[model samples]
Target: MDALTRRSFICGGAALAAMATMPAVAATGVKTLKNGKTTVDLVANKVLAQVGGVLELTIKKYGKVAVVRTSKGVKGFSVINLACPHAFVTVKRSGNGWVCSPPGHGSEFLLNGKLKVPPATTDLKAIKFTANSKLLTID
Candidate 1:
């Protein structure tokens, strides 16, 4: 492995320090739906019209949810929360996954909400959803 540079070290240290002191985010403005059988009309959701498209939905009790059209034959969609489990910061889409870079703390998670990098020990919270034809019923 390559040795860490001084600049990289300093930046890393700063990010970690920020992560340690960052507070949980205040209430989100997005109105989340109830955690029950909530139906999402695919036809109405233009973003999900194409395969590989990702739709971010907000639930009443839950936080931001990332709903993606999966290419895998097993299922058509995968849904997960967008908040970083470690810092409560909203994660941004990074390549094929989600990444949280709040100050010094850096974390990455797969689209399916699996942890791909650390500073985050746990995977993102999964939101259960069932797809039928063009509609998805989330629980």
Candidate 2:
């Protein structure tokens, strides 16, 4: 093997740092109802216990979606589609929000799916949902 060069070492370190900063996508348990709605048990999804936590999951009705904890109440959450409105490309989590990746034109959205930057004029599509003390049901 070749000896490690200063340039290679610096580049490697930078790459590792980038990877470390990338957001981790967590999958939450889901239940599909006979009425075609989807349900998530709030207690089972520990992440939502804290504000700003997010759970990513695939729904039959909405390709990819994220359920975000916005505050501390039954109404303090948001469920949004992951597809970028610009090109229908899937946006990935970056920093405290989402960034439209390549194959897309670099739109950005807040964690709650609010539009931050454009190429995309709208926020991520919000899916109708209702929450109780123990469950969140997506309509």
Q: CA lDDT, every prediction?
A: 0.69, 0.85
Candidate 2, residues 1-139, lDDT tens digits: the string is 4465565465445444564876675656689999999999898889889998999898998999999999999999999999998879888776678877655666779999999988799999999999999999999
Give the clash count for model 1.
Answer: 7
Q: Extract clashing residue pairs from model 2.
A: none
Q: Which digits, one per residue and each the tens of the lDDT, describe model 1 over residues 47-129?
A: 66566677776666566778777764326788888889897987766556777754425687886779998889999888887
- Candidate 1 lands at a TM-score of 0.67
lDDT of 2: 0.85
Our tally of clashes for model 2 stands at 0
